[model samples]
Target: MARIRTIKPEYPVSEDLASVSLPAERTFVCLLTQADDEGRQRDNAAVLNGALWSLRPEHTALDTEDELRQLAETGLICRYTGCDGRQYLHVTKWHEHQKISHPTASRLPACPVHEPAGWCGKCKAKGKGCARPAPENFRSLPEALATPAEAISAQRPCTAATDLTPAVDVSAAEAAAPGKAAG
Candidate 1:
């Protein structure tokens, strides 16, 4: 009987070994393939393990000292300066005094809370405060008009259901009924 032999498939080579002897073009291809495989593996692992996976690749094997220095000089990629004078990666400063110019001769300081308020209709109609108005000149008419009317009304409805008697008719009712008390 003839002797039977079996050959096992070789596992994919690590990136370090592939980069060492490959030509520049081949090395790039190998590096890209390795990165893709690593990413897929990491994603699979994350799914299987039920945990957060780092999206940013570990660059230790690919990066040289020069590459690291270059990245460092470019500053933090996601940092922003907050109004509280702190360097934050997520929260940003809101400039409440930012000005918006109208098509006419006006500019208004943007309110951080309400934001733009559609070019201040009253200011546009009045042809004033179109742009960068002085604090003294920044009187907002719409804000004044927005007050609750019920709060400022001079007359309020009587809450007592039994006190339906009109103020002028109370004396007339007492005189007609004789024994009825006037309240």
Candidate 2:
């Protein structure tokens, strides 16, 4: 099933996307919607061509395979063979880019190379980097927003009640009313 996917403003500007052909760039974006909640999808060129480029008969499975290869080479996606002996691909920045409110369990197998067996979003290796990293052109939050509270607030509208900073001083305005005299 196809799911809604987000396209970051930096996607078009990404160096990886720029390196690939226009068809390959479109394929990369189309794969985002086709991927499961865990960003895993079948890597068969025929299936991808049928699902993503059916309207454009000119785009053949061979073209799709070439696009997939470009995406894998650019580090935009990781292609691996599952234990089931089937080809699969995982979007490298799916977790970082897609904010699924209630993610559905993935039916596809995780990438053995990028993700450990039975990987559940967290990595056991302390020093090693995670499978999902920010895109090449995207910058992560600064050190000031490293905290959970600050990070959460940064995403939504901030009010006096929910804001991390000190609340407004309303006492001065209250005391300066027309009926009240200044002390």
Q: Write the per-residue lDDT of candidate 2 for residues 1-183, one digit (tens) a residue.
A: 888888999987899899999999999999999998889887788999999999999999989988887888799998765545566789988899999999886656656566664443333333232333223322222455368886677886676777574475557579678997656
TM-score of model 2 (CA atoms): 0.64
Tell me the deviation in Å of residue 135 in model 1: 3.9
Q: What is each predicted model's overall lDDT from 0 to 1?
A: 0.26, 0.76
Model 2 Cα shift for residue 72 (angstroms): 0.5
What does the lDDT come to for candidate 1? 0.26
- Could you tell me every candidate's TM-score relative to the true structure? 0.14, 0.64
**Displacement of the residue 25 alpha carbon in candidate 2, Å:** 0.2
For model 2, the stretches where C-alpha displacement exceeds 4 angstroms are 117-183
Least well predicted 10-residue stretch by lDDT in candidate 2: 132-141
